[model samples]
Target: MSSVAKVVRSARGLLLRGSFKQAATQLRADISTGPQQQHGTFYEFRTYDIKPDHLSAFLKLTDDNIQLRTAHSELVGYWTVEHGGLNQVFHIWKYDSYAQRTAVRAALAKDHDWMSKYISKMMPMLNSQDSEVNYLVPWCKLGKPPKQGVYELVSFQMKPGGPAVWGPAFQAAINTHDSPGYAQLIGVFHSEFGDLNKVNVVWWYESPDKRAEMRHRAHGDARVVAAVRESVTYLVSQNNKLLIPTAFSPLN
Candidate 1:
């Protein structure tokens, strides 16, 4: 709350506590330049492990409900795992803040039609689901690639000091990969709310063979080798997921 808001609240204590709190919140909202997105935008990343036979059906059901889910917040990107984890579905959502996320979730929960058309139908097809809250790294910006390209998501767990120990090395490696010819870097993000010290790098490729050739070339580059060697000292473990955009994905 602002200083003015505090003073007003003090003077208006005769009102109920709830009313006073609401007044202060309103005042803060009024004077804000914009939403909290300027501070650090948050992303909700989800992965659904589904039954092999349900993949096509699930994607279709989800595609049909895009409007319902997007009514709550921004859908950054969505894809189905292709190479690493079979029948896995992945999606990323952007929210201005935790309060906004909570509000959007609550609103969606109260919508009966949305629940019946989407939540109820999609839940049965998924074997399991996992979610993470992440923020884009300071040096990296979220990017957009044609939804038709292949995508690879690499999740990295770094040593416990967070980005301090591994950031520069990783950035150097990313720089090396973004050369004259290579897989396109989509975006880079690190954990913000859960499972600390984890980083996710997304890349876009034209084809599986192109990705393979790029990897072989990247491995041969002296700069990439040096960067990876330095970064690995602080890297605990890493996993990758290859994805293809489903129909109706905004990024596509």
Candidate 2:
């Protein structure tokens, strides 16, 4: 867990003592200091649409050359969309700040190994690339699960009002997931740039069988059912992707 997560947990304990205002004040104060003041670490979520016939080839190229990129920074997670966007490879890269991202790209630009052996050849294989930057929500942070597991990324596109419109209900929904141990919450991130109302929560499972069993049991869970019913009213659309971690992915 990150420092932000620790602070949130501490504040949450105070709320039980009729100190909600104090907790909120402390949380606000925390957010305004250090990295939180400037949005802490950032994530680059990039989706690459590949040519149908070129998908396999493109993936091969990616697996083969990803080291060139990871050498400069971190590849948080990577996957191909299975349920929502077709033939798309979605991945997240982490950086300390925008300045680090810029410096890393500059390093890649100067590396002949990356330019000649990969970039030039890989560009034509992609149809389009969409990118966005996001920040982790205060109560959520990056996670590291076992290296071998099934991963799921659930993205919620909320109504225009953002977190304020649905935070309480959504938080209630998250609480239910915790008690049942339905899945391990890898992280929850909210869009900072690009489409503004998007939020994504990533989860991991021990196995496919485990995930199926959990969902089947969760379907009958009343607390989860109730919280989800209330949260849907503030959502525009939702997407889920079952991801298989790449060999080089940090989150794997």
Candidate 3:
């Protein structure tokens, strides 16, 4: 196998042996290039571990209500994990500030439709213990603009041996491709353990078509193709929604 793939396989072995933090740190360091800071709004990354049966119902509700409309605020992006030794669902919501998030969530909680259709659907499979909610502070040191518009969130669960190969392939795709309706490429992040065993790559697109175009290009790229085949077992999931200023404090 290629050198990158070899690195990934080794990493995966380490992760399986319970060295999650070590594997993650190695991957982060391998792909450590670009400005240290970028322009972007703070985000709340919420993670959930749903029941296998309830997955479909929850996704349906999200697509119908949360992903499609902007009644409360922008959806920003969404993703779900299917394979790769890890099983979970994750989505990112944008807010103008912490306060706005509080208000919007409260409103959503009270929305009769959301209560009847959305919440009721996922009550069965929801894993209350493993779920998490956290704030993402973008690397503001870089001058890149904060991404706006519809976006897709891709979360990766890198095994101990996967990072060396996957990291470069991912970076190459993001840097070289011409994303059709893509607004910007947001920062990537490592997952917090209480959350799940994963890391994330956030992509910004103006429309679904644009997002598709970028993915097509990335998949077609020799580097990404090679990386996918050799380096890691990955999972991708997404949600399409608008982002708005948080209505209230998530902390409060």
Candidate 4:
């Protein structure tokens, strides 16, 4: 078993015995020994639902004008929904800190070209928009695939009370699939905005068919099945989206 699983199992036994103090101490020790979470970086995930008739135009406009806005910050990736949603575009932006994000937003508002050439034309093409700020889960870092391919964004709506309640099992499950090379784990993020206790897992595959094959193989692996079984006890609900990278996406 992985150290994470070991700690979680040991801690759970203490809790079952009503040894809350010992369980807390065990968790503290495990945390100290684990990889430190990167708290300095912030990622903004933005989703826009475009009018069906305007989707093509929106893509062209973004391809031509995204540089103006990206000048103020880093564009991690940009993708169009393929399976889970219709007429939706999703993108991620990286900022060194919250203050950096504030500065970027401020600069965008003042960029005349961005306002006139993009946002002005872009807003009317949308039916709705949403954004979430998130941090990379401690055990994960942004990763790249061997080459451009499709990406899957799995959103987990974990039960309440935050990571303190479900982080260990969640991490263990992720580590199981990731460490085994079952699929390319790109990133794992925990929401800091929108619904609380939300976790997003990004995976890359050569094709949808390959994703299916790997998933089947993974399910057959006892380790993965066991890890998933343990993790789901804390899950409330989950959904996923298959995304195709835009031409200018860094991940592509």
**What would the per-residue lDDT of candidate 1 be over residues 36-127, giving only the tens digit for each residue?**
22464788999899988888888888888888888878998889888889989899999888899899989999989789998898888889
Off by over 4 Å in 3: 1-40, 67-69, 85-87, 129-186, 189-200, 203-252
- Tell me the whole-model lDDT of each prediction, alpha carbons only: 0.80, 0.82, 0.52, 0.90
lDDT of 3 at 100: 83
Q: Write down the TM-score for model 2.
A: 0.80
Q: Write the per-residue lDDT of candidate 2 for residues 1-252, one digit (tens) a residue.
A: 545567889899999888999999998786444323246698899988998888888888888988887889998888776656778888998889888999999999999999998999899998999999988877776877865787888889988755655666676787788657988888888898888889888888897789899999888999889889988877899988887766656666
Candidate number of the best lDDT:
4
> Candidate 1: where are CA atoms >4 Å away?
1-38
> 116-179 in candidate 4: lDDT tens per residue?
9999999999999999999898777799989978999999999875676678899889988888
For residue 181, model 4's alpha carbon misses the true position, in angstroms, by 1.9
Pairwise TM-score winner, candidates 2 and 4: 4
Model 3: per-residue Cα lDDT over 65-95, one tens digit each: 6632357876544555433313356555566
Q: Rank the candidates by TM-score, best first.
A: 4, 1, 2, 3
Model 4 ranges off by over 4 Å: 1-38
How much does candidate 3 score in TM-score? 0.43
**Largest TM-score belongs to which candidate?**
4
Candidate order by decreasing lDDT: 4, 2, 1, 3
